[model samples]
Target: MADLHVESTVQDNTDHSPQNNEDVQKCHVVVPTTGMKFESEDEIYSFYNNYAYQMGFGVRISSKRKKPHKTYYALGCHKRGVYESKAESSKQSKSCKTDCPAKISVIVDYDGTCAISCVSLEHNHALSPKKSRFQRSHKKIDSYSKRRLELNDSAGIPLAKIFHSLVVEAEGYENLAFGERDCRNYIAKARQLRLGKGDAEALRDYFVRMQKRSTNFFYVIDMDDEGRLKNVFWADARSRAAYQLFGDVVFFDSTYLTNKYNMPFAPFVGVNHHGQFMLFGCGLVSREDTETYVWLLKSWLECMDGHAPKAIITYQCRAIQGAVAHVFPDSLHRLCLWHIMKKVPEKLGKLNQYKAIKKTLKSLVYESIQSQEFEDGWSQMIKEYALDKNDWLCSLFDDRKRWVPLYVKVIFWAGMSTTQRSEGMNAFFDDYVNSKTSLRQFVEQYDNALKSKKEKETKADFDSLNASYKLMTGFHFEKQFQASYTNAMFKLVQIELQCMLFCNHSLLKTHGTISTFNVTDILRGKRGELKRKVVYTVSFDEVGRDIQCSCHLFEFRGIICRHMMKILIEKDVKEIPSCYILSRWRKDLKHRHYHVINCYEDLKSGGHAKQFEQLCSSFYEVAHIANSQEKYDYLLKCIALAKEKLSDDSSWSVNTNTNTISQDAHIVSEPKKPLLPPAQVRSKGHPPTKRKESKIEQVTKKKRKINVHEANGISSVNDNIYRRSYDFDLNH
Candidate 1:
């Protein structure tokens, strides 16, 4: 048992007088004093213990022996009561001097009893109940929980459900971890139905669905710091899927995402003619080094289900070329003219020269240019520029010829020249993905963007058919052309024939056709030239025995000269060759019925008729404005107005040349005896009398002066010509 004791005593050491006798009696043992009295040690100790306990304090009392007959009481207790009592007294003193406006009472019911509570003089209110502080705080927590529960119920979604949906849409369902929202939702749903607490098989099935769905959500993985591809494993999977769906002929190109110190290499791949970007493969490289190119190609090839591509179209880069040659040896490689054009200035120096170089390089692709011409041009260019004359350039030029006719036809008919399809797709990627984006996000966004663009393009193509058909047979053509006959026109026709032949030959080769027709024959028959008129020229130059015609058709149009046509005609060709018709021009005649008669009607029918109408209107307006006759009339009106304005300005004068006759000059007199000599001569057998000593020199001089005056008059017509230069300068 714990020890418990209380003791108290008081010391008295003074002689008392008779008046103090009453106080002594009041202090006597067992005496009850109504007002106040000295208490014995036992009573004092008991009172202190009770007060200490009430005040939440403990007290100990000790009896001290100060004298033989008297004892002293020493009390020790917590200072809480003393401090609290002093504080109360101080508060009371302050309250007593100040008066509040009105008495305020608060009623409280405790244990079925009513109590009126009022502000005390010592303080604003009674001591605060310790329970009240905790109760107030507890109410706030309860309110918060109640509001949260209400929100959850109204939304009809647990916090876990919302979070799981987000994660499923983000990282995918299969990758959800134990604490992930999806997992929690699955568990909660399962338990709420009184199902088993743990179902490993169900959990596995959920993850499998998530993983399967993740494929639909594409992702691009960039390279890690160690030069390994980071998250883009999906690219490999996607490439395989694409290959399975569509056979090879993938167009690939690389572009930078940012100018930051650390940047990812974005390599994109697209299907052949569909212009669909199947995937964007990205990786980090220290620099665009040879190893990086090799790895990129290898990774892409691997992602392509380890199957060799039939062909790869990309920009011309040495590293890329080398890598392709090494890795995709079987793949026919082609360069994107869009990128090549952008890159040429850096290699050749000077942008202005690009036009000329492009034109020259473009001719290499024309099949009409004989192998001999290509070789000659290649040699000359190499010699002029001191290039290496490598076999690679030769092969490049050779391969370009195979596609040149298609490119020309597409440009002429479809009006699509550059690889803007790829460029536009890349621009879309830049908009959707930024530097800080993770590989996973880039993949999803790129896939979405690609899918969207493809759908848009399909719709656009459908809508564009109307405009394209109109453009193929529009009035603008007639307005733009004037009747003219020139040897150049015939020369161009012959060249066009040769180009057709080249294209047809390529098609024949590609399609394995049995029929063969040369372009030269058709050209000759169309030009009304006989076979005998064809002439072959031999030169010591690279072309050797190649034929040349007076028209120089081959030189101008990079085609077979008309002479070749006459020779081909002598061979007696029958069918029109396929190459003569460009694919762009050779549209399916079946679709001709769909031509839009009215643009508004076509638009109402949901097509690109409105755009087509606007384009046609613009073309017609420009053509009309460019009419020569109208321009000439406008010029004449302007000239008349200018003359009127000049007449109005009195200070303005037309300068005229001054002419004067010199009166100081006189003619010398001649001898008059010349007539007598003429008569003498007549007397002597003279038909010779005609000599007649005439003043012929003076007459000749006069005639010369008259001619000079006439010449001056003729020269005055050129005065306007001189004025033209001044006029031009002023106008400028």
Candidate 2:
């Protein structure tokens, strides 16, 4: 057996002449050891055609030639002629086989070389050209069908499935919409045909393409001309999602983003117990405009799945009030007391009158007075101001019926009467939202800030709960049980004790000290009246342990006043009863942990310093004036004593006449000339008899000048003196 080899090379320009052919042809031949036979040209042609077709090659076989024992064949052409050929030999010698007759075969080509050869036939199978008749038609169908059935990558998840999945993963998707991961998974799954990668490099390239596409779309949709995202409207899906997660009680407010009055931007906020204002929307409006307020309220309600809120608190803006009334009719609308207080002075026309009004308003809010008492106080306020009765003020007082009792219990005791809670939340948010954030990023930051605030508030609420419990049960019972008194009776006694401590401490303390003094003989018998007087006046009730005192320290401090302490000792309450200790009364004295003013350095260092300095200067001047009055009083007393000494001395007198005179002479020098009869004076006489003048009067009279500084302690040049003469003389 032998194997067959067939090889041919073809070239362009088919001409038989080798000179004209820059073409080459190569050939391979095969020989068979066993006798080989072609049998017929038809078979050779069939085999050549089959081989050419199977190998996907062009072939032309030349005519096959047969001899007595061998055959030659040429295959393929170059230069329009067969230049390549193969020869085979078929032979058998007598010594080679016994059964078969010996035969020798030789095949020769154009070169006439002969050898024994066997054709070794190996069959190669491949797809035939006839089989591809339907390929083009099938390909056309595939391309057209693929186009008709084009599946959107975004559609693969089915909106329902995407929504459901997001809802599940995000726990209702509260306020979350699609982010990078969501978008990536959606693109990958829905666009499997387009985006699938056959290799790692292809996968990386696909991801880069997707990122570019997503970025372009996100940028166009979110950002404005300045490349800053318009953080105004929340996506509809997100708004609904948040409504599903959080029920009503969503508090909303707004803050300015820029200082520009013209380009006003307000970021609307919603707050929770965590003190976080989850920014849900934004708008453009002035502070005084109500249009934004109305829109915000409507949008917020729509966001909350159309659920009505239980309450709303905001600053005292008339526009806001009108908007709120229009939008949330059922909600309990309240004014932020801080804002109300701030605006009160403006309403009253001057800041000078605010203090008095503020005090009165505060008392009205917090005090548990009867309706009549409230009315009387209100009337008195109007009278004091000489103002006509205002309907709004009356309405305010009547509105107290809605929330007063509860507010009085909680807010009054806490010293909070305002929705300052919202302001605090706003302050927290102002620090959180910055210029760089997109709406999506802002939402995420808000959620995180809220979580932190919730943790802190939870801890505080727990501590307050525990304290309240201890105050009500633990401490309350301990004091009652220790005193071997029934709880109700013990509480009654405690109230009386507290009242006495608050009202009368000094008298009780003095009485107790006096009683001890008599027992120890600390007081002498001469002081016995004082001791007895004090003892009789300051005795603690033997049955109830009530103490009567005049110091009123007990009424003021509410602690076990020193007087109460003495009474407690006298009653053999050796160990101080906790009942006498009012924890709340001592709260002011206790160390405070919370910051009084905000912890912001700007507020403390700048605004607060100016106010504190002004207050200090005012109090200093008042103290100086008060001290000056005390010194003036003592000086006045000394001046009075000096004036008394000047009146008592005789040498201090001044002589009025030219002749020297003693103090008695100066008093008696003035002469009485004459006296009329009482009967004549009663008759109203027209004229009287002339009298002779004294010779001393007829002599030249000297006009004397007296020094006024010597008489009245005032320095002056001269004083005129005139003497009176009582002479009843009638001139003819």
Top candidate when judged by lDDT against the true structure: 2
* TM-score of each candidate structure, all chains considered together: 0.34, 0.29
lDDT of 2: 0.38
| Candidate 1 segments exceeding 4 Å error | 1-212, 215-233, 236-240, 259-261, 272-287, 350-368, 384-424, 434-444, 457-732
Q: Quote the positional error of residue 125 for candidate 1 in Å.
A: 36
User: How far out, in Å, is residue 260 in model 1?
Assistant: 4.6
- How big is the positional error of residue 458 in model 1, measured in Å on the Cα after superposition? 6.6
lDDT tens digits by residue: candidate 1, 300-366: 6665547776666655566667888898988766665555444444555443455666566655443
Top TM-score prediction, candidate number: 1
Model 2: per-residue lDDT, tens digit, 1-732? 122233424222322111221112232422123333343545444444444333222344344577755566553311123223234535532221112111222345333444424322222222223232222111122221122122211222233454455457557533233343444454444334443332222223333443343331110112235433222233222223333323233444443232212223344344322222333334433233566567656765665557766556555455677898999898766655444444455556453566787688656554433556566776788677654565545655655543333232222111112324334444444444433332322333343444454456346434433432112223333343323322222333354443333232233234433432111111113343422122213355554445543323233223233344445544565444444444332212222212111111111234665686576577557556656767668656755886688666684876577656556555754552222111101211111111112222222122112243447765554333332331111000
Give the Å shift of residue 355 in candidate 1: 7.4
Q: What is the lDDT of residue 681 in candidate 2?
A: 11
In candidate 2, which residue ranges exceed 4 Å CA deviation? 1-250, 255-288, 349-354, 389-421, 433-732
- lDDT agreement of model 1 with the native: 0.37
